[model samples]
Target: MKIKLGLLYGGKSAEHEVSLLTARAVSQAINFDKYEVYPIFITKVGEWIKGNPLMGPVDTVESLKISKETIRPNSITSFLPIDGDDASHLDVIFPLLHGPNGEDGTVQGLLEVMNLPYVGNGVLASAAGMDKVVMKQLFNEAGLAQVPYVHFIRNEWKNSQTALLQKMEGNLKWPLFVKPANLGSSVGITKVANREELLTAVEVAFKYDRKIIVEQGIVARELEMSVLGNDEPRCSIAGEVLPTKDFYDYEAKYEDGTTNYAIPAEVSPELLEKMKDAAIRAFKVLDCSGLVRADFFVTDDEEVIINEVNTLPGFTPISMYPKLWMESGLAYSDLIEELIALAMERFEEKQ
Candidate 1:
């Protein structure tokens, strides 16, 4: 019997548009013969909408323009199990969401309460992976190499910017990256060269999230590797990103199509092996299941520093996660199948 898969995408997050794009890609690649797909789109206003228009192309912004006829806006819908009983339907949920509310364990928690099986990590893993501060702590505890940084709550920043600035300056120097702790796809991120830009950067970051992270900027090459499966996870061939801007900012990641990626990045076999090992280690440390894309920074000294791990990585055709897997000998269709199977396996294990 074909599995009934609910492809969940879009959400109350800054990366909502990106999530839509990812859903579109996954919808196109999934094998129809093996699984029946249900497109579940979550609007930016936190409403779940059911429709076909949600799984369209990302190039045309018009496809994303919600129409009254295409979707039942502000309505709650239900999914049934593939078999067994009429009330029990959907076999599993495949979340294609990116940042914050979608990828930060909130959705996972909802799924847990609903007794639904979903792809990727659970609540604890998702929450830890989404928060830069928390992820860094976990990485440190795991003996992983990561950049030094500091974090503060919104109340702390609001109480005394001077004190916060002093604390940041003492721990990290200029050219620091100020980012919202719970955001991804480089949203609300600013690279402050000095004190002149630091204050503005903090203000901009606080607008997106209550927790903010300030990390010491590392002048290094940006690289990413994909990890698939659970327990004994496998790593994909390394890929390098050449951002159009000074850093991979919001525009460089999504808006600006000028940024380029080098699949199977030209690095020595030794370095590649090291990075792949680190990626697997990072994935296992977070208790991630299904798939994940571990991002790293290769410094001038050739030291690999774990930047972050994306539990629900981007799925656009141009996304590095899928591209890396393709380069590692897995086609787009096969990758989707593998993820679905992994999700089912994880569900059965939990039961």
Candidate 2:
């Protein structure tokens, strides 16, 4: 029998629009002959509605916004079959989601409880990856070189404002990037050059997440590598993100489309190997499965400082992860197939 693959997207996240774009790309690329594809959309209001199997690739995003006539607020019963109803039995799920409610282990936990096989990292890795502080701690333990950063919760920041500012000023350099600990897509990240900007940035970051992380900004090239598989993940060719903006913020990532990319970035053989090793080490350290986009900051000296790993990276056809893999000789459709196989393999291993 053909595998029943459910594509989950449109999450209640800052990256919801990107998730929708990814779903559209995956629907177009998926091999309809080998598997039956279904759409499981999580609306902005947090309702889960599953759509029927696609006869062929969806041509438009509007066509994919399927709503169950009977679906109620926050209910997912429409997705669960009644008393062994085979129609609702999904062989696997490919979650094309990014950021908080989707990639931060909440959806993964739901799948775990339902005993459904889903793509990408498990609850632990998802949760850890979403929280920058936890992810950095794990990276440190893995002996990965990282930029200096200080993290604290909203309460701590509010209670010890003066002291925290003093600590950051003393330790970090002039330009620091303040970010929400549990968000992606460069949302709620601000580059502060002085104490006045720092205060405003911290306040802005707290709007998205209770905890915030401030990293010492480094003048280095932004490089990224994609790792695929479970247990033994392999690294893809490194890609560089050359942002023309002040920094790689939300607009540079998705909106403006001005950021120039150097696929198979100009790297010496030794530096490439070092980055690959660091990427693999990060993948293993996070205990991540399926796929992860390991981002890095490479200095002029070729020092590879591990940045962070996106458990479920941006996956549109033009996104960095798929593009990097494509450059490495894996077509988009083949990458999707491999991810499904990896998902099933991970599920079977757990069983």
Candidate 3:
């Protein structure tokens, strides 16, 4: 029997649009012969609707929107088989979602409860990877070097405004990056050069999440490596993010086509090995499975400071994660197949 793979995308997240794009890309690349592909879309309001098994590679994003009828409802029932459809392959859910309920452990936990297999990290890793402060603390325990940062809940920020400002000013340098504790795709991130901008950035971040993290900005090259596998994850060739804009914000990542990338970044063999080591350390430390995009900040002297990992990094044809793997000799379709195989491997191990 062919594998029943559900392409789970879209969420009540700021990264919803990106998720849609990922779904489109995956639909285009997936093989129709080996797997029974299904579209499981979660609308912006958090309604889950599952589409019929795909017949072939999709052409347009609009074609993948699905639903000429009213939304069946966003509950689990929407994804379940009705009376006649007995052999539907929700066998594995390939969650191509980003941020919050999608990237965080919420969706993973739901899958766990249903006793179903899905792609990417498990509940513990997903929860930790989604929260910047908690992820940093775990990185620290692994003895990974990182730029200085301070984090606090919304209540703490509201109550200790003066003291918090004092603390930030004393500890962190100018040109700070403020971000929501639980978001991705740079959804609620701001680059601030002074106190006024920092204040405004704080308010902007709080709009997306109750907890926020502020990091002292570093002048370093942004490089990333893709790690694949479950118990023994392997790192891909390094990819560099050269943002012409102020920073690689959401716009530079998706909308604007200006961000330049150095696939298989020109790092010395020793530096690449070091980065690979750090990446695996991070993957193992988080107990991540399926895949993770381990991002880093490399200094001029080639010091590899682990930044963070995306539990479900963007899988679009052009996204850094899959692109890095492609550069490492894994084609996009093959990468998807590998991820499905890894998902099955992880599920079978759990049983």
Q: How do the candidates rank by TM-score, highest first? A: 2, 3, 1
Q: Give the TM-score of candidate 1.
A: 0.90
Lowest lDDT 10-residue stretch of candidate 3: 68-77
Give one digit per residue, the lDDT tens place, for model 2 in 126-240.
9999899999999999999999998899999979999999889999997999999988889899999999999999999999889999999999999999999999899999999
User: lDDT, candidate 2, residue 186?
Assistant: 90
Residue pair clashes in candidate 2: none
Query: What is the lDDT ranking, best to worst?
Result: 2, 3, 1
Q: lDDT of each prediction vs. the true structure? A: 0.81, 0.89, 0.87
lDDT over C-alpha atoms for residue 309 of model 3:
96
What candidate 3 gets wrong by more than 4 Å, as runs, is 68-74, 78-85
Q: By the TM-score metric, which is better: model 2 or model 3?
A: 2
Q: How close is candidate 3 to the true structure, as a TM-score?
A: 0.95
Whole-structure CA lDDT of model 3: 0.87
TM-score of each: 0.90, 0.97, 0.95
When summed lDDT is taken over every stretch of 10 residues in candidate 2, the lowest stretch is 69-78
